[model samples]
Target: MPEKNSSSQLIEPEDALLEAFWTRAKNVAKINPLEVIVGLDSVSALRPSAYSLGDSSEEADRLCKLVMDGTKRATSSWVASYQAEDAPLPEVGELSIICDGSGTPHVLARTRKVTTVAFQEAGPEIAMAEGEGTFAQWKAEHDAFFRRECEELGIAFDPDGQVLTEYFEVLYSH
Candidate 1:
């Protein structure tokens, strides 16, 4: 039921299991983000962030499938949420472990691009990149989602608000 491959969704990463997963990815992919990205060798104190996609199990399942199948490589997040939680935006070259709803690691990915755009400016380009439906459908869904999230956080949802869009490439999958 877990979903997501973005560093911004980072929950608390479980170190022991994550280290094992990282080992497997390094062996198979023949690349280590720790070294390639942070200039640190393997087995350092640093570890990739871990997180799930949606708020529910079903959403996680659907989104995870999209990511694994390569149909979805981009994701958008509400900047207000990050501000409320005092979390930084996702950055290029960042690595993350995407987990299923059961909290088991499933994929290793690295961010390739990060852009901040106005909600109203996100159109067909963003929608198509997201591999969702048509631009209209994507807009409607995202608008509703933002509204719901804003309500929960006691923040105003603005179509003109900024959104953090992250484009990532999967490095390995289990």
Candidate 2:
């Protein structure tokens, strides 16, 4: 006779509906930071800079156009919110983009407590710190909560996991 395994639990129908709703909402609100960088670079370069001259001028223009086009593509492909209110909520940390000498972008999420004095000196700093912290925590909590909810709903939680470990390692190494 074959040995029987007895640790499986059945999912409930009501839990399934809630999990589906949460997944959809979470999926709809994700932002691609690469698109933001592209957009900013594209928009910023069109304005003449003090260093624009000779051969460098042509290169600058080319870079600007490339960035703009790339950003446009990224923006269109990913759901991005430009609105201030729609931006990630405020918390206590930030996600920074780390670029190599070649200008390749990588995300580095970090947490730090801010002093009230620093906030007073720079109004925008406070908002930035909050947004970064909130976004990081939200992503973590959402993943755990969603996974548990899915399990309750009898749904497998594997959704093409993108490995953020490599990026974090690169960030910490620096």
Candidate 3:
């Protein structure tokens, strides 16, 4: 007659194998989206630029570093989130860098207005418009810069023809 294997009399070796398997399975389990966002935000805070002095002479460099670090952190978190589930995609956003007339760099959450006189002292005028011509030119340049930065960061923009202007408006309204 074959011997019966009862739970109470389970062998130590078999119990160890079962425990190890469970541990591995739990490690591979998906994390919640909210949890992923929290993780991303935490990671973002740990980045060097995230803590840099905004008024320092190296503000521009720091801003660039912040954007790069933030994007990388967010992307990593996003990938982890995606692996954990098959619904509710993470929202994507743009990073914009604009320079004033004095060549001082300002990081915009998205594309927005900056005065014309801000960039004029930097060099010759590039474009002309009424009311916010200088601001418009600054925006145009910032948009180009933002696109380049996104490319460098390897993050894809929205595919539905959303432009920086719309992005700025959304950001500003909020």
Candidate with maximal TM-score? 1
Candidate models: Cα lDDT each:
0.76, 0.27, 0.29
Output the lDDT of residue 33, model 1: 55
Off by over 4 Å in 2: 1-85, 93-96, 100-103, 114-174
Question: On lDDT, who's better, 1 or 3?
Answer: 1
lDDT of 1 by residue, 71-164 (tens): 8898888999889767888988888888755466778888999988899887687888788778898889888878888887888887789988
> Distance from true position, residue 130, model 1, in Å?
1.3
lDDT of 3 by residue, 85-127 (tens): 4433223333222222222232323323332222223222222
Residue-level lDDT for 115 in candidate 2: 33
Q: By lDDT, who's the top model here?
A: 1
Per-candidate TM-scores read 0.81, 0.18, 0.21
Residue pair clashes in candidate 3: 101-118, 116-134
Can you rank all candidates by lDDT, best first?
Answer: 1, 3, 2
Model 2 residue 166 CA deviation (Å) reads 23
Query: What is the per-residue lDDT of model 2 for residues 81-158, given as tens digits with 9 covering 90 to 100?
Result: 112124332223333322222222222222233232211132333323223234445345435644554454555554
Task: Assess the local accuracy of residue 158 in candidate 3 as a C-alpha lDDT between 0 and 100.
Answer: 28
Relative to the unseen true structure, what is the C-alpha lDDT of residue 160 in candidate 2, on a scale of 0 to 100? 40
TM-score, ranked from best to worst: 1, 3, 2
